[model samples]
Target: MLSVHLLTLIALVTSAKAAISPFTSRPRLQTTFSGLSDVEPFSLRLSPDTAKVCNSTTPGTSGFITADDGQGGNNSIFFWAFESKHDAKTDPVILWMSGGPGASSVGYGNLMELGPCRIASEGGYTVDNEFGWNVNATILFVDQPVGVGYSRGQRIPTGLRDSSLAMLRFLRQFMTAFPELADRDFYIAGESYGGSWVPALASTILRSESRSSGQRGALMVQEDGPNLSPNSRRGPKINLKGIMIGNGLVRRSVQNIGFFETVCSGPASLFNSSQCLEWAPRAMWCEDNLAVCEVDGMKSSACKDAESKCSAISKVVVEDMHLNPYDFRRECHDPDSCYSEMRHIDEYLNRSDVKMALGVPENEPFVGISLDVFKQWEEVGDLWRASDEYVNHLLQSGIRVLIYVGDKDLYCNAAGMRLLVDRGLSWHGQPIIRLRELVPWYLGTKSAGLWKSYEPLTYAEVAGAGHLVPFDKPEEALTLINSWIHGRLPAL
Candidate 1:
């Protein structure tokens, strides 16, 4: 059975805590900000065991940016914008979000994947990740749509429209908060349900009415306050350069085709060909139901049935096969998060001192995935609708996009992502990408992944990696991203 917060959402937005023992919280002092206006860099002590020998500096600014929750009052979106280890002024900014419709980016994206620090599971401490994404870019890991992670909102994230708008409002506030980094090239990235988030936010940014160079927006002082007046601060347009998705879920029906192939006939199939054949009929039913739901409302009963049945397929793998949905290589220890390391991360983030340093609300629990966020999203049947059309919009706008998947993932499997890239996504570049073949992309003379690109859109598959590619293959993940941002992925 699934744990309360542990149902899908990718890594978190859930309720389970790690069951590890003997690792008690160690107290450490950290600078706290009184307001959302402060942008001074803050540092955290890395290790508690050997403070002197292993202590390292992880410099970043953490705080909340208030937005209007659709229900009135205000929504506080928490973000940790980590400074680039290389160049703070000139390096690109990467805004990273986690999926699950309710998952916290802090758990899945930052502490686990490309963040500067990695939390140790055994001793419940921290270590510097030399391959952190901050090595070349300023990465902001946001716990958004209001109630995820350290953020406390007036209500749960109800739908994609609301969540994306909140993200836009958060970015406006983010620009006002950090003017020094305003004009820097910005890119958005996410995984799982973030597939829906990344494109929606990008599209909203493209579609928002305020596109002028000189635009100032008001700021709300409190979490339960009214709208910002004209006497506040400035918010410049984001220099949104590109988008990157790791093991993303874009097209529901097309990805369904990929799912069947992943388990049945793909290069990384977990089930035998004969075993996969038995499940083919249900896959077809899911695809048909989703098609009908698209014509009916996204929240229609037909769509709900399809969503329920499709989820049952994954339930089989998790329950009967005893494998994690994010990464089949691991056992599903926690229902929502699928990994025990997530529990340690949960325990670490909830530590009093850590919360104090981050200036999180004293009582707000650090949920990996909020069941509240998930239930609200599902009730509306929003999960079945596809976001690939938004991907096409980004491509047409001349913004670059990188879609990389971990081969071992089950939920947003590599095969499905590839299928979406090939014929599933509807764009002018669709035909161009469909005809191209994936060539080997090397990591120091050894093959790490297969990639094919035609500018604006680059699709790759990370070898042996799972749902969270950066978490499973940090070095390769970094190399893939650094290559994509700086230049094309070199064949040599």
Candidate 2:
């Protein structure tokens, strides 16, 4: 059973509810960006509660795209698309996803983080987020893996490989619906668990694009198993310009160790050198299990042991040290109600009128994250396995990649991100990565963080931010992405 704390994160992420059962029969449906028609009607407006009280300066729409994941069943992904404030017709396209293996992108990623509007207060109201990502680029927030949020499908996928394949199928359907994006510069971005999803999806897109397009890179990843059917081998390239990941959990072993290292490294250290020595044996065991988990995919006993080992470290930090796993600088106030905004966000989304405006059934319960989906992923040991090989391949293929981490986040902290760049990847740029000096990255007049860049890769650490950097430092996060998408790397 999941701990009370774990279940209570429901508030931070979204409402809590059971996962929707797979449909025995799916509807014959089709949709388009130009016009909303067919099985699902589309609406280009938020609820009255949003418009009446929120400073929603941009226009957006909600719709669903149904696609059959050739592996087993058909999938329908729900999406919220916000047009660019500057010029939607000419701006680049951004594909955003939230990171819980089962988290709602529209729930936490949208309302809580970088969405066009934020939860207003204790009641059901919303306020404008001046730093919303759509300021210059159109953003598509997708609820994925078939069961998170309003998405529905044949079944939840088993591992990173299957989940990614499902997302690839979704993208093909997405491209068919939004033809205007066919030639636009595109970027795939996500955080946390998205660490695996982003790289896996990018690799598939590069490897599976219509071979005639010639944009297909010769990507060979371990996740693209031999069972992949040739007929299921098409993806949307969309002039993929780059990818951005924030505090990603791409390499679990390094991050797991980094968590402990963080508590023992600074002036505010919770464990001194001698105290840290006690965990040396346990750390060794954790690394050994992770190595087995890496090679075994989802079915190894070692992987479950590894998961326990990793969670042990987190438990110590949160329970014993009394520190918040996501933001180590803060004390663990209450796992169930650490942030009051979460509860209000949940209440606002569950409103009948709000659901109606978003084209969702008024009676269907809203869940921010699905425990059932999370359990499915955990059973297969997906979280412990590494997606390093895929990310490394993408880097070597000359795809522009930006990896950023919050300095204060211990969950997927900066130390781990740095190790991922140094030890997890092998590429042409690896030779000079260490030789280059890191420089201060400024948001405007003051330095917000530190960064380093070489054409294909840029890595940075945002100061004074937590696991959700965008939520904690909205202005800085906006400046970071604006600079990145506009080709002004290492400068905000």
Best by TM-score: 1
lDDT of 1 by residue, 309-382 (tens): 87777777888888988888788755565676778888878877677656565687898878888888878777
What TM-score does candidate 1 reach? 0.83
Using lDDT, give the best candidate's number. 1
Tens-digit lDDT string for candidate 2 (438-474): 6899876789998888768888889999988999999
Candidate 2 contains a number of clashing pairs equal to 0
Q: Where's the lowest-lDDT run of ten residues in candidate 2?
A: 1-10
TM-score, one value per model: 0.83, 0.82
Cα-lDDT of candidate 2:
0.69
Q: Cα miss at 331, model 1 (Å)? A: 3.2
